[model samples]
Target: MCSHYEGPTADRIHHAFGIRPDGPVQTDLWPGHRGYYLTSGGDSGGLSVSTGTFGLLPHWAKDVKLARRTYNCRSETAAEKPSFRAAWRQARHCIIPAEAIYEPDWRSGKSTPTRITRRDGGLILIAGLWESWSDAEGLQVNSYTMLTINADQHDLMRHYHRPEDEKRMVVMLASGAIQDWLTVPAGESAAFLRQYPAERLQAEATG
Candidate 1:
């Protein structure tokens, strides 16, 4: 359940080692990449979409406003869902840049927000899939969702809370793994769909 994120880099500064506000809404609001949207909400946590602006394209979708609800695609069934199946097969691949990602620790009495970042201050390339939806106006919009995998021993035992019921986090790919992740066959990529080692990541409590 990734919702909040932050990006404070120049729009033209593509592929830097920091979070950048680029994606569907940025394209709609700023017009650039046809696929991807950046979210800095505490819940969305800065994601990259695969489509143009809006997330889904109904067979009868008549307006772009419908997109506001289709921002996320569940990883468990994404490959089987009609809405995401096609994109998952051919039109997938996006880089969700983030400086840090937040997760809640409920046991702390208050909902303690922890900021998880790379130890060396590098960007975390969250794996994503995109889709293109067209409205009655023939305007195409792209959107995306991050994939999640079960938490590893490190994230479950250290970075995240213990007794973690639904221990899950976005599938963050390393910089060196991004190229293979983006171009590999979907079936083969599933092997790469695992939690990043918690040792290489650090989580700091945030205000």
Candidate 2:
């Protein structure tokens, strides 16, 4: 699962996805961190970029620590996990635009930071589910969690994280399918939950 990413500015996001920003954009986002998420704008065929935490916070969560663990939901079980079922069922889909995603690579007998990006050097659109949670003060906190699909067989992604751990990769949506991902029928969303081919991706170990 991705714990951090480099996102674009609001203007760049607006131009790239036609999503109007509802708040300021966050260039750097990490789990339990706040950022801008682009959600569908209904029949208008537009999008709304709103400030939301990077981690999902179910309405029932009492502590913020849970946000860390809920940052990534298994696409295969998102519909069944209590923390993500509501958002998945309600089709509260969103997209997280990222310049690069930082993960740990443990292939060298030691863990090292690794950055993953499109081979074309363009921003990646990651599919996610968002939800709204309110605190005692009635503060509405909207948050999101990336959906991950098994990637054990992926040529590049499988190299990240610990070798002993099951490999997984974030669901990436193609530029042409951005709107489709945000508005796909709930029952059919599973069709988009698959590994992005490694040939179009690039990765480097960061010192």
Candidate 3:
């Protein structure tokens, strides 16, 4: 799962997606932390950038600990899973703009941190789902989770994680697909759920 990533700045987001931010800009973001995501700006017919908890918090959830496991939604089961069904059904989709995503490489019999970025050295927009839930204080708070798909066939992604574990990769959108990603209906959105080609990605071990 992608628990941490380098978030794009608000200005960068506007330049890339033409979405005016609705809140403060953030940089480094991790699960349970706050960050910005781009979604369809309801009524305005344009993209809207807004802050949300990196981990998802379903409206019916009573424990924030649920967030620990909800940061990443399996693309195959998102529509059927209790944790993500609501957002998936409502088509509450968003794009998580990131500079890089960190993963663990255990090929050396020990874990090594690896940073994955675009070969073009540009932002990577990951497909995600978002939901708004009321906190204990009765305030409506927003949260989101990235959507991931199997990557066992991927050349680069398969090299990460333990050899015994099934490989997974987040759904990264192409520069031209951001608009369709945010507006596509839920029933027709499955086409967007797939691993990015390793040829377009670069991964390196980080000290």
lDDT by candidate, in order shown: 0.57, 0.86, 0.88
Residue range 46-116, candidate 3, lDDT tens digits: 77888888888998988566787899999889989999999999999999889999999998999998999
Candidate 3 minimal-lDDT segment of 10 residues: 17-26
lDDT of 1 by residue, 1-207 (tens): 454544324443245634453342331221122333332223444333222542454445466555555545566777887767776776366656666666776666667777777888876667777555665677765556567666645444244544456566778887777656666677775776777877788877786
lDDT of 1: 0.57
Q: Give lDDT tens digits, candidate 2, residues 20-48.
A: 57667668787888887778888776777
Model 3 RMSD vs true structure: 1.4
Candidate 1's C-alpha runs over 4 A off are: 15-72, 156-165
In angstroms, how far off is 134's CA in candidate 1?
Answer: 1.5
CA shift of 80, model 2, Å: 1.2
Candidate 2: segments with Cα more than 4 A from true spot: none
Best-to-worst order by lDDT is 3, 2, 1
Q: Pick by lDDT: which candidate is best? A: 3
Distance (Å) between predicted and true CA of 174, model 1?
1.2
State, as a TM-score between 0 and 1, how close model 2 is to the true structure: 0.95
